[model samples]
Target chain A: MTALTSAVTAPGVLGRSRALVRPALKEAVGRMHPWVGEMAAYSFGWCEVGGGPAVASGGKGVRQALAVLGAEAAGAPGRAGVPAAVAVELVHTFSLLHDDIMDGDAARRRRPTVWKAYGTGPAVLAGDGLFALAVETLAGTSAGPAALRLLSASLGDLVRGQADDLLFATRPWAGARRVRPGEYLAMAEHKTGALLGCSAALGAVLGGAPPAVVTGLDRAGRHLGVAFQIVDDVLGIWGDPEVTGKPVHGDLREGKKTYPVLAALDAPSPATAHLVTVLESAGDPAVAAALIDEAGGRTAALAEARRHVAAAEAALAGLPIPAGAADDLRSLLDFLVCRDL
Target chain B: MTALTSAVTAPGVLGRSRALVRPALKEAVGRMHPWVGEMAAYSFGWCEVGGGPAVASGGKGVRQALAVLGAEAAGAPGRAGVPAAVAVELVHTFSLLHDDIMDGDAARRRRPTVWKAYGTGPAVLAGDGLFALAVETLAGTSAGPAALRLLSASLGDLVRGQADDLLFATRPWAGARRVRPGEYLAMAEHKTGALLGCSAALGAVLGGAPPAVVTGLDRAGRHLGVAFQIVDDVLGIWGDPEVTGKPVHGDLREGKKTYPVLAALDAPSPATAHLVTVLESAGDPAVAAALIDEAGGRTAALAEARRHVAAAEAALAGLPIPAGAADDLRSLLDFLVCRDL
Candidate 1:
């Protein structure tokens, strides 16, 4: 482990970042057209459907925290990162809206997805609106042009990653070409890491950090994002539905080729073969999980997640970030990847 | 009619604009990731499915022409407008992609729509990618910040317009909440006019035009867009399928609440009442068309189109546009509003 990872995780960092970002996000989204603003509010859990009062519960705001921590690491005020934080959250929400439609996901956060609550058309428009608003918000900042470019390029990577995910899902595993583990990692990086990296880089830029420091923060973000996704893949099968706000073995039941399942498939053992057979047959989730566990899939996934976390710390080690801010980021990384859900 | 309108429409002006904008659009889209780039190419009718070679016939490039004309009006070379032109066309294409999915349109330009051919998921992503690419392309220009702001605000208006349209379509029309003619026009202004206005404004800004000139050009573009939509409503019910690349009475059959139909419904005549009844019952397209025509809906729509065109001309008249550029714009406006399809 790097020196950064060895430091104690900072308490209250996540909550403090949320405190800074939430109001800013609300203001930016409020500036949208009424109808879209309402939809966005609902999507963000700011208000109940049909413009009722705020409900308050929302996502973990990990990206927003990262943005704040990144800015602080460069010795800028936490408020200096608000625009980047809001922008990143908006992008994340936009992706969720579209992804729910594309994946036919019915629930998110234990509630009906936007596409389910609102029609597909409105949901699509709302997502588009959020994306435009994100760019608009960033463009209004002092770092407008640079931030816009970074976010736009990150969006491109996101779409490509989603396209690859869909393509891989549809392609047969027995085909002449199957998605390799490396390709999956690349897709994860593009899909999840790109935006996180952008978020950090944007904060660093907003803080007026030097190029090398910005690049280092970006790399750190990418590593954390990869680790986050790998941990998510593990949770998809083993996580408590009450905690995760998702069904147990959700990914396995859907035959999702997530890291653990893919790793199990790559393993050369009878249990691995059995796991593949169970998956192909749409067997029970418990049986599939047991088979995967017997094949050491869970262990391998956990190891991979740890490896990424270590890499994330290593990326931060050489950076010129202040010690306190680095500890905050390390805390964030730990909270993200080491969560039970 | 202006002296320019009295003359024959410039024989190759549209063709010339297409030639300039198409290559620039292709190059910009080429800069996108291969997946989205291929999808964009296919959507633009530049290629067939599965990454085939270029096939070519695409949109009318009206917005591209307007961009170039706006630039020339500001005394810049037509090529100075290429980036703005490409950006507008990308925005237009992005709208088409989403609109097709929302409207369940199976074909466009006599070929399968992107959503129909490529599935809803990829189509949505492709639209998103195009939007990002549009802003990205604009951001690369010297007028990047201003252009980005214009396009982003225009996008917000576009989403609001789409939302209003969907809301109007779903709402009952017999009560105090019936969609007013003014509201429909406003929606059209938001949905169609905003981007066209941005396109012109962008061109003017790119050409280093004065602020007043930019605003005037934007107003002219908005009027032109309104006129174009009104003309399209007239043709939707009356134009030959062979000419419009749509089924005869296409809008009527689909029960689209276009300008003409709304005008007919608002008319104080038995024919108007009968048209409403027919529409409510999903009556035959021929019957609905006959009722609308008898109620003078066609005439009213034509008048509205002409009024908007005149307003557009008046907006142009006050600007310091060179006489030749003014004439070109007037001729283009006439072509747009007077065309059969």
Candidate 2:
């Protein structure tokens, strides 16, 4: 476990898959409208403000690694998953580009979000371009239509999750109209879980895995997604802004019904009631954070994350895959949950 | 020719295909998120302002007809094209939904747009949902990977064209930065042609046509799209508001660089110079419209449309399709260019 943790801690795991996926992803993006391509580069952090080469590259490429590793799990050449890795990464990029605009987030990766760097219209158009590139990345290949279907269906889930997230924001903070934990979980699963599942499913399918293995990886990925989302919810409320590359306590400020907020509100206590009152008036995010943590939301959330991680582990167990691949997938899963930022 | 014109005037051609595609399209739309589904209904004119049924239906279903007729031309049963038809139409709707937002359009089809009825975020999300559904509609079917690839490739063209269109709006009306006629034609063909071409190509591929015929229909549709766009450009300025269901001379006011504007500007006449002056100061759209007409822009545009229409006819002439199917396709082409609105 220590060795695995250290391996994950070195950043090489994410960087390895990121290196494989980035070239193909950039090529696909380069084939789009040139202006939109520039915006896409900015979205990926391959370029700085004026489209120069970036000092640092983009995200951790977790989904890409899931894809690349998912293929390896099926005993295929890990490179066989490049297309799937590119597709999922492109889809993930597409979601972030649009989500930033819809969520009105100003920063990502310690820089302005795409919509903040470019205007909303261009950002949206670039996002659409990435989405198209995602589909084309798979369709252009010899990958079966089933892989394309897996990718496409997840897109519906992604948008629906986003739509529900937006709608939940407008709902009241208390009473019948209040967003329930179960409902939020469902939305999170759709928004987050579906894509992760699709990433693994796509790779497994393309790698010529049997239906059972493909479906198993998909299930495992989905459970991992739930755990990953819980971690994100925690980071959104409690992580340092500099570390997370976003405004800290944003979920509290946005009045978003993240799992912690819901868990805190769900508990019936004087502090809980006071937390609701503070949230109702759009109170200080710090105070809201304290109230939520004081109500045991943090502990409850960590427990739930562990539960989901266990479920993910259970799904991963008994899979007809090589032992080495299983270890890699488990390590990544552990890294995602335990990630501080 | 008179008889063909009368047949095209009857509206039955559009209606026939519309009826076939509606149920499947509706069923697809119904499977989406309910709230987003309602917004899609509003987008399709399936429902009125408040979610009730509309007396008037949606667009003429030209793309759907292209797909269906394209399959029929390939000697398959017309129903073989249904999935292709649904996919193309969904893509079309997705473009319009997003385009309306980008264009800041408030009224479409004499009613408030999705963004106007719903908010910008919801409308954008609904458009994205429709796009996913479009891909899913094809991927869920037994359509060959080729058909899906054709559909996927065209999305890149569609978004690129759209991005260029937006960028074109901000360019100087005259200069090196001026939107050139050739460039605009290329943009129009992409913005308008790619999907139309894909519609025909999807149908042909799904209907088991050989590559030659599929490629032929794609070319024919691309040419027809240019003609269709020229006709639209003409109407954008000179057509009656009541008949077009839009503000008359809206393109002139919006400063959109349509074919007529480019042509009128290209002609080095006093009227053309005055047209430039008027446009620069944001003079009356009526005056600009008259100046454009005086500079022979209308005639030149019509001639350009006729040339593209002839090119389309030539592309269709030697295709290995049924004679009856060819005639039906030709009739639709003619109807599209000769449409009043």
- Shares of reference contacts reproduced by the candidates, in order, are 0.62, 0.65
Q: Write the per-residue lDDT of candidate 1 for residues B1-341, one digit (tens) a residue.
A: 54354346643567878887888888998988787788899988889998887566787787888788778888998888889999899999999999888877898887889888888988998998898888778887878577788888888888878878877887654456767677888989889988888888888888878888888888988888888888888888998777777679888877777888878777887887677678888889999989889988888888888888888888999998788778888788777775542
**Model 1 scores what on Cα lDDT?**
0.82
Q: State the lDDT at A269 in candidate 1.
A: 67
Model 2 residue B241 distance off true place after TM-score fit, in angstroms: 3.2
The digit string of per-residue lDDT tens for model 2 on A59-153 reads 88888898888888888977888899998988899899888878888888678898888777777788888889999889987887889889988
Highest DockQ scorer:
2
Cα misplacement distance, residue A151 of candidate 1 (Å): 0.7
Judge the docking of candidate 2 as incorrect, acceptable, medium or high: medium
Q: What is residue A328's positional error in candidate 2, in angstroms?
A: 1.4
Q: What lDDT would each prediction earn against the true structure?
A: 0.82, 0.85
True contacts kept of 1: 0.62
> Alpha carbon lDDT of residue A248, candidate 1?
89
TM-score of chain A of each: 0.93, 0.94
Colliding pairs, model 2: none
The residue-by-residue lDDT of candidate 1 on A87-141, one tens digit each, is: 9999999999998988888887767888888888788899999998888888878
Give candidate 2 misplaced runs (Cα > 4 Å): A3-10, A240-248, A268-270, A284-287, A339-341, B1-10, B268-270, B339-341
Worst 10 residues of 2 chain B by lDDT: B1-10
Most accurate candidate by lDDT: 2
